[model samples]
Target: MGTCKCHLKLRKPEDAAAACSKVLELDGENMEALKNRAEAHILAERFEQAKQDAHKAHEKDQNDRSVMEMLQRIDRLIKMASRKDYYKVLGVDKLTATARDIKKAYKKLAVQWHPDKNQDNLEEADKMFKEIAEAHDVLGDEEKRGKYDRGEDLNEQPQGHPDPHTMFFQNGGFPGGGGQRFFFRQG
Candidate 1:
């Protein structure tokens, strides 16, 4: 459809997908529509839909070079999705998240999963706490976040992080770490 192609050219991938879907509904076997929709889905990071469309396109024409390339790219993205995603660790959607959001999420999750609070599940808590810290460290910094956004942060840990215990004491035992609670508590 001209609308679909026009939207794609304008870099409005979500619009392109919608337009292409309208054409596909009328003609399921339209190779151009299928291919364009698949591309739009890829740009939107909707891998499952993109995969489906790519497969359909491939079935329609196994010899299509562009479809084959799309299939390969999808496979690669799927694999990358399996990695430990810092955005996911921080419980934020990367597309709409800002630095403040990432920081807020990290603070919340870190406290919830702090090792002292999860003595019965220390191992899991420690792992989760570390993950949250790492997410904040990477995504909270412009340079690291940029590298991470570009997929260069492979298995990277939070840099120069103090041990959990040290961080806790240094911060005064909580986010504000004022140490007032300890003075008033019996435990």
Candidate 2:
């Protein structure tokens, strides 16, 4: 006899793998055991092995929804792992992030994206810099800054910043007339 799937659900990957192996020994074609083990591997982020196990489960039961779901999940995880976050790129955390820290992170990131430093790549650096700038801007404002620290939604537009098109227009730009005026041409 081997452990049921539920018994191994919350266990560590290694433990789940052991239980799954036992289940497989009892019945080599146990799709449930294979799927559970694949899930465990996903939690552990052993993606390649997880992909293999998920593929095997799909093979065993071609029409199984669980297998298809697991494969889609694995694809998403693999993609997420490939794209790094700005915090990781800067090597800092929100708790300790001061203006100085922001400057330092920017400098380091600039170096990484610098045309001289990365002769073969340029676009990635710009995208990284934009993210860094946005993070700094939100964290720097006092009300927005405090909200961010409290894990509130800082992305919400600030209260006083007027809608540009509705409130003001000058030379088709903004903030000044700049020798041009904008008004509805009403007859």
Candidate 3:
């Protein structure tokens, strides 16, 4: 038995990782700590460490989905790391595509590989969708697209962002500074 440290519940990856590491310092074979730390390692992009930690946790508990997902993400990220160029991800040539052209290309590819349209190959479709989403997301935003063009880090937000309010407020501004004042009728 080791010294019991502070018992704190972590809701985020960094905190979880710290707690897990502290626990592991006390007990190396702690499965829960290993899994939590592995997840944090993945979030932190420490793929090799994540893979090792996930493997250890998985060996202890084979039914852990978090461990399995982390392993799969690490494998995919390793593959993607080989093809870091955004143009390659979108299957497009450099300087030949405008933003609209990229959108059209993404739409075409998305429709072709949409999971609903390809029921027999959902996994493949999902992978294609993710690629398309990533490509479109980068190429659609000016800042991200420019970074991507320069081969800089462009893992930013994506495209087709819809308004959450559904155009409730027009360009001319709202009725009474924001909303309308309604008088309730006495029953």
lDDT of each: 0.88, 0.71, 0.71
Count clashes in each candidate, considering only residues at least 3 apart in sequence or on different chains: 1, 0, 0
Instruction: Score residue 37 of candidate 2 by CA lDDT.
Output: 82
Off by over 4 Å in 3: 1-16, 87-187
- Cα-based lDDT at residue 128, candidate 3: 84
TM-score for candidate 2, residues paired by index: 0.50
In candidate 3, what are the lDDT values of residues 1-187, reduced to their tens digit? 1221222233355666777788899889888778767767766677788789889988988997877887887787665556656566667776787777787788888899899999999999999888889878888898877765544544533456434344445523543346556889998
Error of 2 at 107 (Å): 11
For all predicted structures, in order, the TM-scores are: 0.50, 0.50, 0.40
Flag regions of model 1 displaced more than 4 Å: 25-27, 87-125, 132-187
Locate the minimum summed-lDDT window of 10 residues in model 3. Answer: 1-10
Per-residue lDDT of model 1, residues 19-39, tens digit only: 999999999999999999988
Native-to-model Cα distance after best TM-score fit, residue 131 in candidate 2, in Å: 7.3
- What is candidate 1's local distance difference test score? 0.88
